[model samples]
Target: MNLKDLLEEEKRVVINPLQDENPPLLVVITEGSTTLARALIYRILIDETFGPNQSIHFILYDSLNFLAFLESTAIEITACAPNLLEGISYSADSSIAFKDADVVFSIGRARGYEFTKNERRESFFEEYIHVAKIHGEAIERFSKKDVKIITLGYTAARIILQFAKSIPPENITALSLLTLKITAALIAAKANRHPSEVINLITWGVNGENSLPDYRYAKFRDGKFVEEEIKNDVWLKKNLIKGVRSASGRSWYSRSSAYALADHCKLLWNDTPKGEWTCMAIYSDNSYGVPTGIFFSFPVYCQNRKYKIVQGLDVSENLKKYMKETARIINEESSIALNAHR
Candidate 1:
């Protein structure tokens, strides 16, 4: 037998049957580095499965046209971070890679741009807009009706999950999720302070839109993850510092994006019918009296291997103002992109 047939035979013999049965296909579209994408694929294979049965088809579309940008990122990651991704199989053929993509994660500009937090806000807006342009172009390339495109980590409840992991396992009889601006409205039964006092559930010491993704918190109340009130503030600055201390040098975007991808994969592949919802970044079109044709973040759920934005949540005046501000930023950024190209 030829090598290709031999590999196929090996796959059939080794991989679990449940996993081999129509495994979900996940694609990561990034500018130069596939470090985070590969890491995500590893996590999906190892963690998403219930028992021994775990497998997934992964693809990496290194969307870099400039050799310098590609070469620089490739060198930086390899020289600084080794084996950020060790073991995961991905297809090379674009047709096969994206034949049945369930999730598409676009990190930033495809041609690649060095993103150091700019001293000026306008510069940062340019960076953000670059990401939006790349996302739009990636879809235009793969153009799948069902594939959900996300902005790195904003589309995920990552901070909440981190906060959950921070709490004592014994204390977590119920559930706990955190908002971006986490305020301690509900007191933890085990917290040293009263369960009523406000605590900084999560304090974002870092900059960027992550400081403001429209995400929700879930606390285990009645046996399931029920959505709860989301308040914002600074209570976890020290904790965040400690976290950065414990593991430094990695970019927050990659770390959070990987987790976000894992979360999406888990829901799309393993979880079933209940349709548990999570916040996601979706393009808005006055869907709920918002803006027309701008990327917006909203709560969403995955069902039958597909995702949709959840609707009819109460929108306060402050929330509308915030949404409007975000829309303005996105629109202005798009203008910047168009102007630069012109």
Candidate 2:
């Protein structure tokens, strides 16, 4: 499929608010291994939904090794300079490559810190906050009207907390949720510059089971903020860790327990409705294997050209606990950020 094909009147499917606005350009910023995967998926989806000839701009940062790996793939992508973090130093021009972007997908953050395990949390918080501010500023500067911004990664709250300077678990979770809302607000503000323009913010992540003892459902929901939860019923053991092992071609037994727990929850919940949900799982045995619980985005569809959260059915006590712990981890990360700000 090509860009022209996607913009065709016949191939277009109007889902609510997302109308065929001349096959909007997609801009992606990514870090680490997932960058390649997301880039491939984005290209395939764009081609399938629009057409092959459509021009999509992908902005990647971090890990040149991974970039080389991605270059070997079938997806045709262009590389931009200075990297995401480095680009921050040149914020004035960060958006230059994204001048025509209609949709922006951002993933991961720079991970460079050598501190005690306890202090590692604090360092990560500071790093992400700095990353978000730079990225946010760039978006505000370069984005065109009617652009949709989708942010991947579950660390938004942690980053915010680092900016705010308080590490309470509750506060960190609140900040994370707030970051999502703020991201939406930022995009809307940019779109408002033009008449009749709209901005959509789609945030994605895994559904943490609620059956665990350390579950922080309230925090994950961002203080009772109703959001959609997409459930995957495939047994976790069967599907979850396969990606980890496959991605690195090695056994990551240390993370096997985490993967097992996450997978077990999948069996406990009913499957979310098809077409309403987007699901992804990984089985890798590497450093990446440990962060399985982080929430990430998947290509999704809604009544509008936008994406909505998938709502999951009621879960069991055991699964609920696991899910809660996942949420807690998310909250805990944010807490580190909060502490750093303080």
TM-score of each: 0.53, 0.42
Candidate 2 displacement at residue 169 in angstroms = 20
* Per-residue C-alpha lDDT of model 1 across residues 1-342, encoded as one tens digit per residue: 554442232111111123244353444444434566545545554564322433333344443233234344433433423222221233223343344454555554311111233421466545655455444443445545545444443211121112223322111110011232122222232233332233212211122422332223333333321123222233233343333333322344454446545654455445333534544344453755656544444555556544465667666686567667655654554444456533
lDDT of 2 by residue, 107-154 (tens): 435221112346454655456666655544444565554544433334
Deviation (Å) of 323 in candidate 1: 2.1
- Off by more than 4 A, model 1: 1-19, 23-34, 49-54, 63-103, 109-148, 153-218, 222-253, 268-276
lDDT values for all models: 0.38, 0.32
Worst 10 residues of 2 by lDDT: 82-91
